[model samples]
Target: MVLPIVKLVILLARQITRPVVHRLGALAKRNRTFRSVIVPIGQGYHSMNFTSQSRLFGVDTQTQAEPLSTDEAMNLGSKLLGEVLVYGVSASFLLYEYHKSSRKEKIKAKNRQNEKAELQGKIQEYWDVTEAEIALLKRKIFELEVKNHS
Candidate 1:
């Protein structure tokens, strides 16, 4: 019973790693960058079995493209450089607007401080005069009511 179970586990392990083995095989086959010591010396390849090769190099299949040429690489670089310049100019404009708004905020806050100082003394004088008049009227009304009751 244990022997059968061990065999089954071994088969599962092989199934799991099979894809990884095939991908490494395909990458070494296609890209020169990874072709160094991993592939055996002088072991030539037969044509790729279609399913595995399609799965491995899905986008780069004969339909879409061949490898990039030198001219293509140069064109791609120039396009990227133009995009960088546009982004730099946009960023500078945004930074200038941000500083302008911050300066306006500082000026507004200074004006508010001056207005508060100008109004505070006038407001305090009004409140004091109003309170004194209200107290005198209340005392006069109380005295008149007391005399009428007596």
Candidate 2:
């Protein structure tokens, strides 16, 4: 019975956390940190494959003919370069926005803390004034009693 409950709790926790974790992972993957590594490695592998298959087998052979024309290659490279530039700019913007949001949250938290402290100080002051008033009333009553006795 306890085992089933534990499993259920774990499942619920995963369900709740999965979306947040996935989003963060996606963001990281899209960032420059991952791009610098993934882009070069991917390009290198693609180039190696293309070279081995196209150049190693000669141009006269039908099995290993030239894959792309000069114009085609230039167009493809330009398109890829454009895509990388766009992605880089967008990722940088995302990072900047993330930092801005975090800063705003910190400021909000600090303001809340200050407000709470001020409220606590006001409560303490109220209690102190109330105690002083009670003390004064007690003193007045004692003086009246002494006068009546006299």
**Best-fitting candidate, scored by lDDT:** 2
Q: What's the lDDT for all of these models?
A: 0.57, 0.63
Q: List the residue pairs that clash in candidate 1.
A: none
Which regions in candidate 2 have their CA more than 4 angstroms from the true location?
A: 1-66, 139-150
Can you write out model 2's per-residue Cα lDDT over 30-115, one digit (the tens) per residue? Answer: 67564454455445545656767676667433353234543343334334544455556657877999999999999999999999
Cα-based TM-score, every candidate? 0.40, 0.48
Pairing residues by index, what is the TM-score of model 2? 0.48
lDDT at 34, model 1: 53
Worst 10 residues of 2 by lDDT: 69-78
